[model samples]
Target: MTEDTSWVGPAMQQRVPWVKAVGITFGDVTARRVVAHLPDDPQLHNHVGGPHAAMIFGLGETASGAVGLAAFGSVMDRATPLVVSSEIAYHRLARGPLTAVAELTRPAEEVLAELAGGQRPEFTVTVGISDTDARETTRMVVRWTLRPNR
Candidate 1:
């Protein structure tokens, strides 16, 4: 299967403007990169006037999901794809525009290819989100078990 052009990074950014409204976007993909951000927002504060953890999670989740979805199209049938699991960790408080970047470091893609050959295989994609200052506020590892059908 070929990649799903519709879910490309730019399109997702445009469609899901809400995320962009919150100031989160995808970063470098050829290799590991950090999430870039501006100063923190006081509006989304958690009493302490600092960025809320939920906001951080929201940013990380959407970014991770996009990477997985894009990769799914890259490897599987774009018609019907599979939904998998995602794991993430909050390393610190975020107070700026963030960058979420991901990479399929392992040979799991090979496993996914094998599984896609039969009953649809489950695979994982590791994603990381950090601030532009080179500080990492979140680390995530998302698994997407995909197939042509379900």
Candidate 2:
């Protein structure tokens, strides 16, 4: 199972018990576009009672990674990739429901084609985390070495 589609996405959640336990959802998983869902849980609270930094970090990181997965059309058949590094900044306090969007950087289509045909592509997945109120809480940049499946 992979996180590129609904069936596979939810199915693979079992592999990451911690993430699933925290109520993170892989809503849209496709190349060039990535989106994720997060519930406003109390466990994600900070000293001030807003979402904790780690929670925001997790949401932003996952969203960025998902974008790379989506850039490949389907992550169902690819090898599990690891995050080499992540650098993010919080613009404001995160509140309410949050949505993360990752738009592919570089030549997305060409890179995906190469990856599907047996190539390892290193790229940056830029993502933004926002709330249902249409407010952005953070901007994240995730860099990874993507090894896709044929």
Candidate 3:
């Protein structure tokens, strides 16, 4: 199914403006992936004068969460998506504008099947943070759990 992600950024900023403080904005969303951008700004600088790690983590999670909703919204109407856990590895200091991209690792059918059986299911999305030069700066695996809204 096709979904319109054009409103994602504005809607997200309205829901969580703190994310906007760190310069997070939705870049693109497609059936295969969701991408977010974090501009290179001094406001996001660390004590050492580099991008803060926490902000980077937030950017990744935001992107992944957007992907989750777009990819599974139909089945997730009565379910709530929660971030169960995440693992991130920073390869180098972020020195430029950053882009976080999240893509599904398993087929959508598999995840929906579990939900159809009235079982809470978990899905993982791998978000890669890349610099303006397209160099990988960090990698994060965010595990999300979908539970009945009750």
In terms of lDDT, which candidate is strongest?
Answer: 3
Q: What TM-score does candidate 3 reach?
A: 0.90
- Candidate lDDT scores, in order, read 0.57, 0.71, 0.84
- State which candidate, 1 or 3, has the greater TM-score: 3
**Worst 10 contiguous positions by lDDT, candidate 1:** 29-38
Q: In model 2, which regions exceed 4 Å deviation?
A: 1-4, 73-80, 112-120, 147-150
lDDT of 3 by residue, 1-150 (tens): 566766666766777778767768787786469889988888887887777898888889988888887777676567888899999999988877899999978877787888888899899999999987899999999998889877
Ordered by lDDT, highest first, the candidates read 3, 2, 1
Per-candidate RMSD, Å: 4.3, 4.0, 1.7
The candidate maximizing TM-score is: 3
TM-scores of all candidate predictions against the true structure: 0.66, 0.77, 0.90
lDDT string, candidate 2, 1-150, tens digits: 433344435643666676687788877676666678788887778888777888888877767765654554355467456676787988888787788887668876676676677777667878899976879989988887765534
Native-structure RMSD, model 3: 1.7
